[model samples]
Target: MTTASLRALLSHLIDYAGLFPPAAVDLPTAIKNYQRDRATGDAWMLGAFVLPISRARDVPATLADTAASLPLSLLVGPDDLPPPDLQVVSVEAKTNDPAVVRQLVERWQPAMVFIELNPADEREVMWATLRELGAGAKIRTGGVTADAFPAPETVVNFIVRAADWRVPFKATAGLHHPIRAVHRLTYDIHSPQGVMHGFLNVFLAAAFAWHGMSPDNVERVLAEEDVANFQFTDAGVSWHCQTLTTEAIRAARREFCRSYGSCSFDEPRADLRALGLLR
Candidate 1:
């Protein structure tokens, strides 16, 4: 990906503020929306499935057949074993036993393995089991979804762990907008607890974990509080400079919705606000 392309795509992966339909929209419609707003870039566009395992098991044969026809990378719940044409399978770490997990990996060999980093006991076992699976088998990553309460520090530590293990993973939930800001309104606990801020998380992950940057140095970048600072070109040059937190990113999303009338990448910068949806 070119520097500009990488920066542009990362912006979308970080926020995902563009799609503004009511929550009750059907899956097909959501998929269509994504199709309409599709961005043409080398950076991967990770798509998600809202269906639970049982329901997904009954996916229309036509949908399954059409899945491989789609452009972006698709992800279905672990519980739901959609056809391989559907792309990645994100099995909930808790729902499946290790043997089951192992079987799924051996059977599908998906692009990624998503686990929810939970209680100390489970977390330890899950981490080790995943490590045993080894690299090139599948990309392994964890997250704290809306249904669970995970300390942000632990979440950050987990990212560090993944990096240490050379695991290239992405996250979702609570990260709705990106950034370390507090939601004083006590929004729906059913939703994921997003990062305190996108700028901080990206800077921390890149500087400290991915690039071996020091904490102090990352803190300095956070002091400036710019997402753009962390977004560098494939060539390592700066393009489309701007910094953003989860809140600011959300605010930007509101603006984007007003301007574009819908959430697709129809509006490039506006669409980028949805980057946080990566998780």
Candidate 2:
């Protein structure tokens, strides 16, 4: 891709990154120069693609038939078809009593699977289930808010271990915002359970798990006056390892927190608010 096109795509990253809630511009906005953008040869552009949620049974087939140029995955619910290219998963949804998840994975054999982590069982049961599913299967694990909340450290640990097992992973949901600690003294009194913070709270949790860093060390990092310290390199950013400028890295840290930050979809502007990009 031309530098200009790359700049445009990266601009979208910043624009989306700044919003409290991650907003979807038209798919075209994500890919105006499809071929060039794809060829830009930047780490940020490497795994970048659209993730669509589908309800129809034929969604996978339809995606395979159309949108061949773009890589897409389905957030499945009652859609019965061989896992085409991408599949969304959670521990309970896949490994539940009937083993529907196992059946699907073995059958469709999608390119990747996003596994949601459950905190209730300390995530051991969930990881054991995936191990039982076999190592040859290409799968990635992720966590959702309902399964845990704020951050799912257990799920993050599973993802790291899964990597050691040759399983690659990525995350979604409850992660649409940037890093920051939240402590509304009033919220504690009103909620009585605990205070709910932003997605950054959870992202740091995952970073801590991935690095095998002590929770105490993580707390120290979190407690630091600067949130930028939490942005470290990962497999996703390995390609452009040399060129990752300080500003770019800082921007990435901010975007990571923003994209995964705390927000809800009761309104379309949730992501916008979390990023402080919207009024």
Candidate 2 lDDT over residue span 191-236, tens digit each? 2232233334443433433444455444443334333343333212
Which candidate has the top score in lDDT? 1
RMSD (CA, Å), each prediction: 9.4, 9.9
lDDT, candidate 1, 166-267, per-residue tens: 554444333333344443212345544432333334433433444444444444443333454455433332313333334433332222211101122333
How close to the true structure is residue 128 of candidate 2, measured as C-alpha lDDT?
56
Worst 10-residue lDDT window, candidate 1: 253-262
Q: Rate the local accuracy (lDDT) of all candidates.
A: 0.39, 0.35
Candidate 1 regions off by >4 Å?
Answer: 1-24, 39-51, 57-65, 71-85, 88-92, 95-97, 122-125, 135-151, 182-196, 203-207, 214-234, 237-279
* Residue 27 displacement (Å), model 2: 6.3
Instruction: Name the Cα RMSD for model 2.
Output: 9.9
In angstroms, the error of model 2 at 65 is 7.7
Identify the candidate with maximal TM-score. 1
Which ten residues in a row are the worst by lDDT in model 2? Answer: 12-21
lDDT of 2 at 182: 36
Error of 2 at 110 (Å): 4.5
